[model samples]
Target: MKPIITTERLIIRELQPDDAAGIFRLDSNPAVHEYLGKSPITTIEEAQNAISFIRKQYETNGIGRWAMVLKDTNEFIGWTGLKLINTEEVNGHRNFYDLGYRLVQEHWRKGYGFEAAKACLDYAFSVMKLEKVYANAEKGNTGSNTILQKLQPVHTESFWDEGVETIWFEFQNNKIGS
Candidate 1:
């Protein structure tokens, strides 16, 4: 697989070794990491480690998160793709797929999150033959909830953990490519 997914204004692909600096910039922005439950990464080494880990996920599972690039500028904006997440305790399932995306601060307020995430959802349901995809966002992330609402995912539940509440969303088998 070439690992490239081209959209009208974005390119979704696997992370490359040279992307470490760009990934570092995205990961190191405190504003971007505010709702991410941790501080920004401070080192290129951490970005490199993340790249290796993502690649390993692709190799082992045939699916993983993808780096998103702006088509006009070819600049790394962020990432969006599928991930196997722990849903056993929450949904009574051991292995479940989730759709996720994160963009740098500068890209916020644009439609990039929805664009990239919709593309990933298409890949998951159409290409990967997945029947469902789940997503979660911090309770106060109105932007995220809005984007997910456009997808018509079922609003599962809201739960508080460690002082933060998260809203869960799920898109099931019937709505792909609709």
Candidate 2:
């Protein structure tokens, strides 16, 4: 497997076909899907398709979300990384790159999201040469919003998909470590 970034406790890597089962497990958990605005995945095929799309994003965008795995246990936890949000209103913004992540319920409150996200922000600003990275979380998703606040302050509240209220955060490149 082509690993993208390896942290002390996690290995951020490209999604693979074999990862469908793990992705299914992660996406099927209602608790995990609670804040994501979508229902739990009902089939492994859906996860497989998602993996394929993620692979395509890596090829087409050069920077896409990565599958995060625990290093010591080698278990698939979830994903974290950057993505391009090309919607017109969002596209009009100066910083179109967005940092995102999703972790399994078992991994919640374990600092893995923060650890992996910090690394992703470093890569976005330092390696990818992005000026800023943005992120959003549902209004009541305090855990995700808290993690984002550590990286960047909330710039505004926006509606995602014209419905859910999301708090958007922005991290400028100058703040990233070289």
Candidate 3:
């Protein structure tokens, strides 16, 4: 499949049915879920369902989390991209774009997350012409927090997310160049 965006080390593309196994491997890992509600999916069917849901977002919202693949090996490492959060309010905000990514356990600490995120942000500001984007990380997830910090979001706030304290960041397109 053609990629929506390509970085030096990764390809960002829409999620597909063929990615069910990769999603299963990624979401089924407890380590990968450590910061994401602590609930790992138990079946490939669940993975397929997830793919179906994200795919629908492309049609309805014109954007959604995308599959992140390796450039060297064409491997499905995980997913990364922007998502529209219009259905629910988060940190007193809705109808905004959120940047997110999840990678397999083996791919952790390898900078894939940062690479994919940078590409997505470029797409957000340059192609999407978005004014701002938001991201959040569980307080204990240092790796994710580091990446968000590096992005230099204009605003940061702490909020309770499902009983867990999370740090929310807001990145403005203008602030990036200022």
Best by lDDT: 3
Cα lDDT tens digits, model 2, 1-178, are 8778888899999888898988998999999988876699999999999999888887887767789999998899998988876644552464288888999899999999989998998887678887777877887899998787776543656566457777777678766322
Using lDDT as the measure, name the better of candidate 1 and candidate 3: 3
Alpha-carbon lDDT, every model: 0.83, 0.82, 0.92
Candidate 3 residue lDDT tens string, 1-178? 8899998999888899999999999999999999998899999999999999999999999999999999999899999999999999998998999999999989989998888888888899999999899999999999999988888888899999889999999998856521
Q: Could you say which candidate leads in TM-score?
A: 3
What TM-score against the true fold does each predicted structure earn?
Answer: 0.91, 0.90, 0.97
Query: In model 2, where do residues sit more than 4 Å from their true spots?
Result: 87-95, 154-161, 176-178
Off by over 4 Å in 3: none
| Candidate 3: residue 130 Cα off by (Å) | 0.3
lDDT of 3: 0.92
Residue by residue across 64-93, what tens digits does model 1's lDDT show? 888999889889999889988653454444
